[model samples]
Target: MAKVFFTSDHHFGHKLIIDFESRPFADVAQMNESMIASWNTVVAPEDKVFHLGDFSFLNKEDTSSIVARLNGYKTLILGNHDRGRSRNWWLETGFHEVSEYPIIYKDFFFLSHEPMYMNKHMPYVNVHGHIHGQKYEGKNHFNICVEHWDYRPLSFEQIRDSVVVSEEG
Candidate 1:
């Protein structure tokens, strides 16, 4: 079966992110190539990938080129830096779907570009991105930033299992 994966903060073509996030890539080209390879390694063409945000810093043509070469049916949740493009523009660029705001999945995962206010009192798990190297503390908050997941998309089962393990330990 095709898997459902989540990831974000790719910041593709953003050279400054290399230094900002302390990414080990020697340069932007290497960073972009390595990330694309990593993504394709695990995500199949039929897989569904939900990218929380900060997908890219490149222009439409460049971004679309990158997205076309990637594997999976991609969806993007707009992030702070993603405001430059309209939802329709994003759809035309290659993303199968684009959401201007947060969305709920599986009736429990509050998917957003930025971490939402999730506490023990709430029954939802906030799966988010955009913080890069920083992360929130709590079993209810799951950061899918590429920095946290070895620059690869993580499957839904992996995220759920992690939450379960955290709850137990």
Candidate 2:
């Protein structure tokens, strides 16, 4: 069986992306290259990767090229910014599929972008991207953006270890 990995919100080629939440990157192209390199370094050809949303900047051609370069079979969760030309680009790139909401994998909830309000009422853990890790401060529950990881198709066990979850009220 292939390993599975989950990540989100790369925003490649968007120079101002890092500035929005105070992420540190010199420029847009630099940021895009870094993300691609990092993802390739960690991902394997046969692995399955889940990209939550906002995978690239506005250019469809640029986005398609970047997607073609990345490793593994990708499934996309459509973010708010993912529409129009970007959507067409994703289709051309051979992504497994793209959806507006979460997909359940082994009981865990996977969303491309984080829900504005995560209802604690849900039984499974919500794994998503959109909000950078730094914004959360010390709070648990949200995992920050991961451009790449060595393991393909990471499991709930892998993700749970990295995230800090608060006790339910």
Candidate 3:
């Protein structure tokens, strides 16, 4: 059976991200290669992957090439940086689906490119990216940024298990 996965903020083909995010990769090529390998290592072609955002910073040609090499049926939730292209343009670039705003998943998880304002009083758990290594203080928020997950997409089970919801605020 196909499994579901979530990830964000690859910033592929963006050289300056290494310096800005203090990524260990020596260059953009290395970063891209490493991330692609990591992604394929765990995800099968039949698996479903929701990419929260910042999938790539390359031109359509280059982005399409990279996306073609990746495993899984990929969905993208647009990030602030991803606004450079239209939703249809992203579809043409290889994402199976694209969304300009956050969406609810499993009646509980809120998926988005950037962290949403979630609280203990709310019934939702926000699974998001964009803040990179930083994470919110409560179980109501989950950060799936590549920077926080060893450069690979995490499975939904992984996120669910790690996020221990408490009964009390």
| Candidate number with greatest TM-score | 1
lDDT by residue for model 2 over 1-169, one digit each (tens)?
A: 6677788777777777777855556877767777778777767888888888777774667777888889888889887667554555677766767776677777655444774445556655567666654444332344536533321234545776555334432
lDDT computed for candidate 3: 0.91
- The per-model lDDT (C-alpha) reads 0.93, 0.66, 0.91
Model 1 quality (TM-score): 0.97
Clashes of each: 0, 8, 0
Candidate 1 achieves a global lDDT of 0.93
Q: Decide which is better by lDDT, 1 or 2.
A: 1
Q: Arrange candidates by lDDT, highest first: which order? A: 1, 3, 2
Q: Report the lDDT tens digits of candidate 1 across residue range 94-135.
A: 999999999999987899999988767888899999899997
Superposed by TM-score, candidate 3 places the C-alpha of residue 96 at a distance from the truth, in angstroms, of 0.5
- RMSD in Å for model 1: 0.8
**Which digits, one per residue and each the tens of the lDDT, describe model 3 over residues 3-102?**
9999999999999999889999999999999999999998999999999999899999999999999999999999999988899989999999999999
Q: What is the Cα root-mean-square deviation between model 3 and the actual structure?
A: 1.7
Name the 10 consecutive residues with the lowest summed lDDT in model 1: 116-125
